[model samples]
Target chain A: MTTLIAPVIPRSRLQRLRWTFADGGVIARGNLIHLVRNPSAILNLLLYPAVMVLLFGYVFGSAMNVAGGGDYREFLMPGMFAQTMTLGVMTTMIIVTNDAARGVTDRFRSMPISRSGVVLGRACADMVNSVLELAVLLGCGLAVGWSWHRGAGNALTALGLLLLLRFALIWVGIYLGLMLTPESASAAWMPLMPLTMLANTFVSPELMPGWMGAISEWNPLSATVAACRELFGNPGWGGDSWAAAHALPLAVAWPVALTLVFLPLSARRYRRLDR
Target chain B: MERMNSLAVVAEGVRKHYGGAPALDGFDLAVPEGTVCGLLGPNGAGKTTAVRVLTTLLRADAGRAVVAGFDVAARPAEVRYRIGLAGQNAAVDEILTGRENLEMWGRLYHLDAATARRRAGELLDRFGLAADAEKRVKHYSGGMRRRLDLAAAFVLAPSVLFLDEPTTGLDPRNRDEVWQAVRELAASGSTVLMTTQYLFEADQLAHQIAVIDAGRVIADGSPDELKSMVGGDQIDLVVRDAAGLAEAARVLAAAAGRDPVADPGARRLTAPVHDRIGALTEVVRELGERGIAVEDVALRRPTLDEVFLSLTGERTARAEEGGHGEEDRAA
Candidate 1:
């Protein structure tokens, strides 16, 4: 066999980053194509948003009252968007677990591509699904007369915040996915329900018990939900805590912090899977 | 760029542990360029573990490995460019079509767009997967998927190919297909290191055979070198009746000049023989004379399990060598 060795390996740091994205983009495309072929996986991504919109907006919103007198549906929309973003964890975890279990992760690791690219590819691809899920959730929100009372620019920024939150959770999912088995990862969604609920996605943390409310206010999901509500100009619960007072900054901080912790951990685990 | 080297793969005292006993305890191996080396071992013998280390999927706790002229641990990214691996289980994506799996790997291999597409097409045809190229791997048969797995690793005919138990579960026809494909890869001058349970597969494909037990290479040589060391053909006798097993075992043991390994469940006695025809005739005549009926008899090569028993009990050859060395020193 003629040697395959040569200029393939990246020499410079910038070149390395370029190759990582290029390779990651290839991997991301493959994952997205799988979604197209397997409708069930796509449906799983859609299932959470659809169910949450109905369960919260029509059912629970009918009886609920916002703290400062606004339509409950408007308050519920931002929370639903934030909740859907975090729901990505379940899908990402399951996919990563499957690949890890099936030896797909090992195959990727053995290749000459960038090591972090495999993890990054999965995150990027899941982001595409998140974008689509957000669109559908937005459609449902608009159909139910949940209009954004803010400028279009502010509304788009709110959507960007939700996506940023989703992007960071994607790393968490990748890390956990590498840590768990496929069967257990499938059951992972149950535990995540509490994570989404621990925040202000369903109800204001202000209404919860003392310690629980503090936790909810600090919850990353709560940061995104609170931030989205403010940007969309929906009903904000307006708590006195630092996390409550600065939702936008906390939303950015929480996801960025989680990404910082989990991205390297995921890469390390993938490099030596059995260990 | 440096040209190809003579030894394509080399591992020195590579060790790994998963908590309890280390899987690979000071394992070592060396495969010259462009030769097929078969690694044979029983279950949990660290065959797969060793493959993982050399393939750059796992880093050893100690020691070092060089594959395709780069240290596996220190420069795994560089080493990765020159090797292909088909793990124990088929590692291809099940949801993607067979063609997609290869094309995706091709892209990861740093092939340009047009080249990746063409390479996928060529591999699919070569591996007998062209007809089912469009089908998702989940729908492909075990054999087809395995061929595709081989095809995936063979892209660019990687300088050193590592296949861990490539034919563990396959019918004869499928096994033949894989063997032929491996032969083609070797002919193209690719260094292939394959771990297998079947002695027959090793005989047919491997230029050098390495029998590993408990994570170390206990024996390494050409097929003939191994054959002569492990010894002549084995005479296997299946007694007609379970009651006559003792008598048949006694006969074969006497003829072969060693105790035959008797299987009560199968009513069989297997013993290694120096002279194949003489041992076969003597066992038959003696059994007839003793009125012990014979169900079947055959001359065959040693099974990997039998080889391990003899090799381990050569668990065996090492202690004797140590004794001889001491005696020589004393003299």
Candidate 2:
């Protein structure tokens, strides 16, 4: 007979952190493996933004022009990047809901691992997926004659800001996902389209009516798009509005505020689950 | 001191409620170390709720529970480190392969990479899943998935294990395999606490059984003790001809001093008797004198099923008739 033996608990903070990371990394790998096994979904996500870029660049570009008369494709690329980052809300929501429904979250909750590992692993995997989507969209944009006139450093910063927004929205997806039952998760994606499209993703906010323009300019999506346009040296709508003038700071602030609100909310909801 | 150390799990006056109804109403249990204790109950009896509280998945509104020597409420992390739970739903990932699922659980338990891999392989082989190790769990049969879930729970061989209706949805062959696995686990020194509606399962595996009703332990004893509570041995007889049943019943009543239950279609009569061999002998002689041909007769101890029925039958019948709707509530 094999006797039961107790596991040695980590006593130091550093050791505990290491265990958290080790366990979290394994879970993140599992999420990534799902992405690999289900490539059609990834392909669809990547293709959707590229198709949008082509549709807007060619179909609508002929009649539309920037305030300063620049290439519409270049102007459209930054907005597309921002829109893609925010659209990740749907993917995150669906994945989290699927895990909760499939009993995987319950399995993770029962283990001796760190409680934060489950959400942290999921966030890590979603960020990785975001990066891949960015690469594919960037390539498609280049194929269609969109170029960043700024130097490499600013371009890199633009990409970083885009990913930061994604990181923030990921928490939003997780919170809403955890809050909703699995049956409602599919319906949850319906609101995301209007959320991304009604912003400055396809057209400049200045082109809309006065009230709609003001609201669209203040959108978190708009802030990221406007900031990325400035960083990438792409064409932008000339406006003196407070939001347009402070797009860079608002871009950082929006994501920070969202993280502050949703991260703890999702964590609390997760801990109180099954109550 | 040694005997005190042998107590693996203990709970006192645990209470939990949902929507103003008590799910675990002042429940208490104590299981000694390295032994199997079966919690027997019907639907809505709070067996699953008790498991949830002991496993640290839920907090009791009022009570104290110590599982594997750590207070469940105060030191849930410590208790979690020392116990494994296979819930009513087999909590395995459908997207991952069987081997991957086990390895994933091992990694979550903080095992190193090489050790996790080795343990996953070992568990798959042990659970008869070696051939299907690489197959996705969604592709596996229900029984295979259950075996894998059980294998995941044994990754660390924790001192105390909780199985909530482990074989509820399994076929006879799969149930036998799980029973064998649980027996082997107990023989290998793990203390098991299992909840089962199947009385035979408790009789076959549990060293001690606790019959729970209305969120409380109504009866607690070994299998034989529980059976003895129902009554003495029963004498069953079958006659060759339907017309001979009345004569057999009369002979049984005279010997057993009680009216025997007759099955007219089957031409059989059964009576509860105190003296096992004496009642069999008296009934056989009386039937022979009456010229009634007895096809079969035997004296047998009461089964756990019978004990369960006699204890819970009346209350359940009343509950059904009253239409309380309490049966729909989750445990």
Candidate 3:
């Protein structure tokens, strides 16, 4: 006990940031270690998108034609990227709920470490997983004759936008995970599939009925997909509708809006665990 | 630093409610430094709730508590920095290996990477989990997991430790192992506040026991003092003949200065007696004069189990119906 009584240094802003990252990194490492021990979950996540890409690009690509005279596989890659990133919400939700249910979150809360570290650590780990998922899907896209005709800078920017969308959705996952028990969080998986599929992930909204097209066009997932297509110079309708035309701004805005709503929500839920 | 503070934990009229029902109603306690205070109670007793509040996991709706010399509500981080809590459920991550679990906790406690690793190794060895340190916790048995959890708590050698029902589901052998570990912790001068449902556990480990029920401490004292509260030693006598039972009862009651409990089937009578030897001799003399044949007579002090039953029974009978039904089984 006496050995533990070291002087408490007054932390500067930079020091605090360093401490936060250090603590958050440790927690993130724990999350990553879980993934290593259970490689099946990561393999499933990686396999899900690859299979989706191959199935839609080869099986469905031959039949459907883009509004522009370009390959449908090229047109579908960006949408798959956006869809994979958004579906990360389910992965984050399940992991967070499991941690909370298993008392790991309580153990973290009881420690003297920063409260934000727990959430930030999960966010960081999920982002890393999202990056891996993107790489696997991109590899699958390349294997099926999909290429970004745009410059390297534009392609990288498109990847950046895809990851940004993932970053935003991770907050939503954290918020939902903390709000619901693990059993209820699994229920989120059902709604998420329809939510992503109803967007421009698998097919263009222009091909759908008028009313359904309008709804899909406004779907946040659609905005990121459209934005990625424009950056990658891939074939997309780029619908004349105002929402579709300004896809870049909406792609950024939707994630910002989601983070604004869910970050505080997740933080509040984490703090409320003490009560 | 005020290193010589006598009391490690102090609570004043702490109150907490879940929805409309009060979990802790005006609970008060004080535990001196370097001592093990066993909070003895039954299921649904506020033992877990009290430990949670004192450990800074939950806030009391009213009243105040100070643990490890820091106000629990006002300075929870400071309190957390000095204390360890192994909750009702084992809080270790099941996916991580036993060593990984402790090392993660150590890092969270702000120890450097090397120190954390070294401490994790030391704790695994201390808790006799060194061989299984590399195995994932999911594969660990209940006792092994519990030892790992306890080892995690000891990573910092905290000044104060709170263990809530640490051995609730353990078999006798595992329970004894935990008891040995707790004893070693106390011997090392770490104040321990453990909540337990087993009276014998408290008797074995606690220097002092606080019997709590209905969100309050119904009785608090040394084990012997609490037992004496229920009453002194009792003398039991069995007669040879059923026909002389009434005579034996009257003589025993007169000698003991109280009505003796009679079992007509066994022709036995039991009565509380302050002076064991004197009461025994007087009862034998009286029974002899009354021509009653006695088969067996012995005097024995009551066990802590009897003490706990008597104290909690009296409180539950008069308390409201709702307090005893809610299980505070939160992690």
Candidate 4:
């Protein structure tokens, strides 16, 4: 009532950009605080990697072959790392979808804040969450006797590649979240099941049927898993396929390509949403 | 003559479509500054769409809307700056505490951290949520969440506020709480446009009511003006059994002049009466003479529900239209 007039928005290009960052920072801080307040969500995140580690490292470790005869637990570590990244993407999608369905997105859209800031905030918040997930999975891997035989530099590169894949998946999640309802988005996320399985994350695709193996190799996820395996000095079949031939570059290329495709798409979908 | 700024919200021929079905078709309204306007309508009536368009959240396919002196589509950012919105759903973050939600909104509105914190505390106290400010919103009851949502909208005390079905799913006590907050907002000279299915809510809060049906404003006037248009008092009766519904309707039709509408679902009959006392007395005597079993009968003043029914029920502009909600117009 007292100050009914709208505050003057900074209109210059640089000021606008500053506002975008400021708004995104505020939203990101809110999301992080939300995470801190809910200890159970963090618990859920921990439980997922813990479950997968037990299933792969112990349950079927002896039966599975790790090509060059290395620790099965080490081989599964990167796979679990890749899988955790994909699950983190689902969490972002679910968060966006819930915000959309529950009207939080509309509330933000109606605000004077920068249009891109909403998504950028979610991405920032979720990237931090993904990092926490990777950390937990790494702890789980260590507990299961999985060690990165490669030097610290290579291990960090592997971690970077895993985060890059997650970053790409985050854009994909934002796009789908903006496009679909919470229920449909939950049911529609593919990477968690077929995509992860098809990728060399769990089983080296070379051992599967020819066509399935090809899909597994080409599954963008496979590149990251293979790249991680090589960097971590984990056992992996470096086959003659082009994807296997250039695992490191493919890990970089796939995420960049995926980001190029989905980043603009998510932004466009956001701008034209409810039109 | 009034200045342009005096008219807080204005819309001209707004239209929107979803697939083949037009959700909002040719809607128009003008609400003056500092007044409460209720966009009253039933389900699927495009009230939500109208609110979205005016709030700059959804674009209108045709026509222009001016909110607080800025064209909604052309100057959406400016409009957004001036308006507060509590969407149909309570959109608060479930994981954040009530206090955190307000502070977040404050910071987003460009308030400094210290100002944001102080303002958030003030709001929590004003909305009576100070006691539970530290509790996570996920654990808060439905009423608490809605109250927080409304408080978030007030972080800036915006000139224009849009509330789409603000109290739709709330219980009576919570509804009262929201209504009280809305009244305070309106009294503080903030223009408010709220949509609701509750006739009583519109009657209680809105100084001006726009009766919307089938995506169009069918009628617009003060509640009293609208009630007067329904002519006079109404006679309502509930039959003891469904079998007596037809007989009760026939007797009331002759006495009240207008044919009574029988809503068989509720075993109730209603007819507009010109001579209130005469019609009530005659109806009671006639039903008794005919041995009609009447469970209850009463004469009541015409409400906004009747006004709405009279406006929308008779036109049926869309043609496949039904009566106003559940009160079936089976004459």
Candidate 5:
């Protein structure tokens, strides 16, 4: 034990500290920058959301009556924000799976970096991507007569909530990204898109049938979509006002619970990669 | 020149099994400091498994390994901190540029911005990859990518470097380049443990050599010690007269009291003799006494291939085909 001690602090401790945050930050930033650097990724992140806004606004705007007395675009905006963040989760899975498949993750494993930092960095970057996607999608929403009647403070709170949702979904993506085989993440997890669509992103719970309406009303994503709607001045989507009263707690809880469930599981998958 | 330290790396009874088949079966090694240890084995002989254990990538099922004075299993992080591994594959990201790849690895080792940048530049220059440093690894040719991978392993200045089959797929020139780079790294006081199926690699780069077969070490020594194991020396002679083959064998056998083989088609005579000069003289005298003339006579030491063949009872070339050629059955 005495031999383990160094006259100067062993460099690895300092190195470990550097790797944990500084390196993870660099990797996270690099991954985001790499995404924006590629023209297609830029389009997928920016242009694709813009396209969704245009397509959905024209196609569904007139027929839909949002819970609130406003344009369908306004009701659709918050849900789309949640949807964008949720979609961003898949990128985390695709990128992590791709990295794992290409043996880059193994390279990181052999190095001195903290094991968790690899997935955390990617998750953080995906969160950023989700935020960007939400902002762009909202910008497009505003172009076509979507406006938030909620006060600036509440609007800011809504934006914060959207980002938080993205953050949570990033972990889910990271967890799923770490969990699924690279092949399955692309093939099997493609179904998550339809699953996302099944929720009340575009339709009202009143419009959805009995069982799905109940699912949409209580769905964790619906909770976020509802809270964002209330904050953004969209009409009431159904949630127990009792649950709505605990909105801040629920916002904090969804991410915390998902992270608690997924981060450790992601870490476990990472540890198993060593085997 | 730095004086050699005789305790560079040591492994004691290290064992690793993937599923049911044992990959490393109680393997052991000792590499003197500042010297190169070449690990030679057929595929699945546990060379890579031993490397993975030494580098702390895989835990050993049994036995102890101390690398750079850090216990591999007990103090894996410490072991990882001191050692660098260049796995069988290049392990470079095809998307990143050569310089970025090295920088990323440097960052993984926790080098600060300035240090990582500086080290990446130095490694690019050292590996002669400076020209292609800014190009994505995906664009680089195989040899360039391999050199960059080797450079990544060196950027951290680790005390113990493990190169697992460092030159598995390279042309002769590229292979020489990698070997030169490895030698330079060792010369700079990095203790290198390299595994290679190329017999000449052990003969060229290894200060010490360990021949592993069937997941166990069959031989460990300097190149000369290993060469001496099969037999210290041998004599080959050609007989001018076809009728002299039988007489040659009889005369050599009578003179040396050792079995001599006659290849009548090639008119060649071969035998293993303990004393080269004395045996040659006695054979000459006895063959003359038997009236058989020798066309040519030459003495030579055993090659490493011959040494491997003698120890494992199979040719090194054939062993490599059945051994080490199998895709790692690792989970």
Candidate 6:
């Protein structure tokens, strides 16, 4: 008689660690697979940044030059990296809003999973897409003779700063997405796009008049852009830049601040959603 | 993870009001462990409201509820950990694959990685969704999506499962598949609380049934017991003429102990009698004695629908589509 036997269980530290990380990995893998499967989103991420690069690189590239001492592409490249990463904020908002609108969030609420795992998993997964977007835009800048004179370590630091900003902004976008109904998420937050764009991402604050420049100079996006520039060894405008002062600290603080502000609000909203 | 032979779900004086209209007005239920309790109600009857409160999704304005030994209000997180809910709408994410949805829920339940994958595969196979596990949910058929949604809830082997109108728009075949799954869930020792507008579904699935109407329970009992409450038999006669209708009503009134009801224009007459066989024997003889030809004959115990009508003066499941439906618009 043939005896039935269970498969021998594998035993190893790596295997045990693999088993331990399996839940988070499955969740993360699920989110990544979703992004890969969505063709329209891929097209948007790939083509939109390329189009923006061609358009803005030509439109504003010749008209304005960096005040400090390098080519416009050099100065613009670091800021563009910061801008591209932040555009990922829109993707975060839309995903959250779409999920909430379609009752998917409600489903997660009823499930037995880690309470914050849903949102945290999405945020963590989206960071990869943001980095990819930044990397591509940076490559495009390189093709246009935009070079980072700063060493390899500084380049890594610049990317780190960009991720930090994206992380923080993702929470803000999530908060807005959770707060607004799906139908109105786009219309209600349309204003944030133009407002964030108006900052010192593309142009120098010194080029604009007093009041406009003041607001642009103080903008958090500007701080991120300026930090990237400093890391990249790009020339800086002479004014005592607030971005320079806030840069290093914000890499850590922004994400924490965003979490502190929005996490509780999202939690509260989640708690009362059934009511 | 196993529950003893105690109440799986219990609620006392549960009250919830939405925009000044009471959704669950002092509703109460006691569902034993490992049993399926069908919360039968019309569209505005507060079945969904009660499920929400018990699942810890909605907090009641007043009263108390416990699911799997955890208080829903004071210990919502613990309650959440013990119960699984499949809501009215299919809540699977369109952008994610069926496999992903289940895996995500598994992670939320804090299952380890290999176990989460194993659980996901098992549920996929159980729900007949293994073939479509990798496909985005947006492409799934309505029935398939519902199956996937239901599968996600089973990832944790939850002690108490709440299913709110789990098979609302499915065809007969698909509805039966869902019913079979629900039975399996209960058989696994999970306490199942389900709400449905389908009286036949309630009759087939519920170990104990509660008929909720106008935000309150009008009747509660086993299917057999509830049917017994309304009497053993009913004879409904539809005549060809209005005069015949009245004659039939008169015949039944005299034959039975109470006065029968007549819809003269519709030529319909209904009479409740003591015993199905005895009443039919007496009614036919009485009709022959009155020279009124019997157009039709029926002998059966009261259906859940009839029981609902007897207790609430209207069909219990019909309110979802009628004037009272506006009351559940927000719900």
Positional deviation of residue B325's Cα in model 6 after best superposition, in angstroms? 15
Q: For model 2, how does the per-residue alpha-carbon lDDT over B126-197 read when each residue is reduced to its tens digit?
A: 788999999999898777877888888888988888888888878777887888778877886889999987
Residues A1-275 of candidate 6: C-alpha lDDT, one tens digit per residue:
11211222226766544544553455567767776888987887678877877777787787877766667777777777877776677777787888776666766676544445566667777887887788778778887787788799998888888888888777777877777766676674577666666677778878778788888877777777877888888765625665546765654566677768877787677666877
lDDT of 1 by residue, A1-275 (tens): 13343436677999888888988899899988888888887786667667878888888888887766678888888888888888878889988888877677777778877877877788789889889999989988888888788899999998998898888878788888878899999888788888888878877777889999988888888888888899888886758998888988988888889889987887776655746
DockQ of each: 0.52, 0.37, 0.39, 0.63, 0.21, 0.30
* Best of the two (5, 6) by DockQ: 6
Q: Per-residue error at B220 for model 3, in Å?
A: 1.6
Which has the better DockQ: candidate 2, or candidate 5? 2
TM-score of 2: 0.82
lDDT of 3 at A235: 87
- Evaluated on CA atoms against the true complex, candidate 5 attains a DockQ of 0.21
Model 6's alpha-carbon lDDT is 0.74
lDDT of 5 by residue, B148-204 (tens): 888887776777888888888787778778888888788778899999876567778
Ranked candidates, highest DockQ first:
4, 1, 3, 2, 6, 5
Put down candidate 4 lDDT per residue, B163-279, tens digits, no spaces. 988887887788788888889789888899999876657878999989888889988999777666767667889999999898899889999887897889989998888777788
* CAPRI-style grade of the A/B interface in model 3: acceptable
Best by TM-score: 4
Residue pairs of candidate 1 with colliding backbone atoms: B312-B315, B314-B317
Against the true structure, what is model 3's DockQ?
Answer: 0.39
Q: Tens digit of lDDT per residue, candidate 2, span A1-275?
A: 23233576889999888887887798889888888887687778677877888788899987887766688888889888988898888888988887776556766666687877777788889999899999999998999998888899999999999999999998899999988877787786677777787777777877888888888888999989888999999898748889899999999999999999999998888888647
In model 3, the clashing pairs are none
Provide the DockQ value for model 6. 0.30
C-alpha lDDT of candidate 5 relative to the true structure: 0.74
CAPRI quality level assigned to candidate 2 from its DockQ score: acceptable
TM-score of the first chain in candidate 5 relative to the native first chain: 0.87
- Rank by TM-score (best first): 4, 1, 3, 2, 6, 5
Residue pairs in clash, model 2:
none
Q: What is the TM-score of chain B in candidate 3?
A: 0.77
lDDT of 4 by residue, A1-275 (tens): 13333475786999888878888898889888877767787778789789879988899887898766677888889988987787777788888898999998899888888877777788899889888989998999999898888899999999999999999999989988887789987886654677677778877777889999888888888889899999998898857899898989999999999899999999999889759
CAPRI tier of model 1: medium
**lDDT value, residue B107 of candidate 5:** 70
